[model samples]
Target: MYNALQSYTSYPFAHLVFGEGGDRKTLNFDHRINILQIQGLKVPNQKKKPQDYSEIEALSKALLTPITAYTDQFSRMDNSLFKIIGWDEAWAPLSSDIGEATMDSGIREGRSRNTSFALASQNPTDIKGELMNNIGNKFIFNLDDPVQIDRALEILKLEKNEKNRENMTLLGNGECFFRDIYGRVGRLQFDPLFQELMNVFSTTPPSEEDTEAIHQAIQAHTEVMV
Candidate 1:
């Protein structure tokens, strides 16, 4: 079926018509949502609650913070990405090693350029789990199937591209919301980055000075017990 939005100036309201797709031989599968006025039920004279500005502002702030933070984090993925399956666009999923070679052949900055193989979605968790599992250790909640992984990637890829960026959106993939309450920004590679920094601190190379700086930053950020 199809959905149609029609507007009429004088009527002061829009009409929503839902129906089956246009066919050469059939038109019987259509229905209009606002046909109630035709049935004499428009404006039943019920008083509605007035608008609440304070509540709206608070909710708006809460919602905007996370969404903006997440998009910003996605923008940084190319810097240290290893295995991202279903998160955002701007990166394409290739089917074979030929494609991996194609990407790595260019010396682009994305760290995930030459991954072994793009995991599929079936029982597999979304790109978040993919990244953690592929790069980190075991997880109790992480799913482990290629079809589920692919299915999730497809849903997220579609949701991300089709929706409005400035407004809130509802997203789902069989189950799971890619964009959630907590901001997705973090030292995602904290352990790995920390290890690398440690290794550099130990290694006698040109990067030893930079490694000392990273060690100081870690110490500065670490919490001290009172």
Candidate 2:
């Protein structure tokens, strides 16, 4: 998920934001990368954590602004903005009514605004049925749990034979079954070098020293370019 974000940020007029969940902190991307971090689903300097509904409402509003702006303009612009909203622990959010509503709105309305969503979660069952049904692409990694694998297969509409079941359970690390809305499906191996690069942007909390070093490096590089 982080790798996809890194690649998309390279595109022109791309705006990125992700929620901080679990132990993952806001990642420090390169100085040039304008990825925004929304902490605890609340704007900075708020006294209390926002209610679940409010959080989703705020997120939906943020996502729709660009779309509204572009459509209201007198002249259609060629260099239109694109927003990528990602959720790291996606299931937690989707479990709520507000979250599901927000996601459904985005999935339905995002394309007109040139916005997209990327979600990551451990268990497919934890995801809401509506959101799961709406997803156009899926990446199934190795799963030891039969229940989870079964749910994934059902969602993907793949036949559950002994051979297919065994393949899902035994896939190596970084190997996954990739399927798109266009009826394409295949097993893919992620490149080792690219995976290594993604590790640098991991959201897992880093030590204070490591965080400072990353900031300093980015600052130094930016200064050199200037």
Relative to the true structure, how large is the alpha-carbon lDDT of every model?
A: 0.31, 0.62
Q: Root-mean-square deviation of each candidate, in angstroms?
A: 24.4, 12.0
Worst 10 residues of 2 by lDDT: 70-79
Candidate number achieving the greatest lDDT relative to the actual structure: 2
Q: Write the per-residue lDDT of candidate 1 for residues 1-226, one digit (tens) a residue.
A: 1221222212322221222446533212122111111111122111222253344332333333333343234434444444332222212212122222333322232343432222332233423433432322221122334454344444333232323221112222122334222323111112344666666545356488877998887887784531
TM-scores of all predicted structures? 0.15, 0.56
Q: Taking the candidates one at a time, how many backbone clashes does each contain?
A: 11, 0
Encode model 2's per-residue lDDT on 1-226: one tens digit a residue: 8886565443223333443346754333222233443333322122334453353444543443443333223112222666566666665455444455666776766677576767788987877577777788888889878899888787767898778888899888779888898967888897767766777766679899988999999999999999
Model 1, stretches more than 4 Å misplaced? 1-93, 105-146, 149-226
| Deviation of model 2 at 218, angstroms | 16
TM-score, candidate number 1: 0.15
Q: After superposition, how far is residue 17 of candidate 1 from its true place, in Å?
A: 45
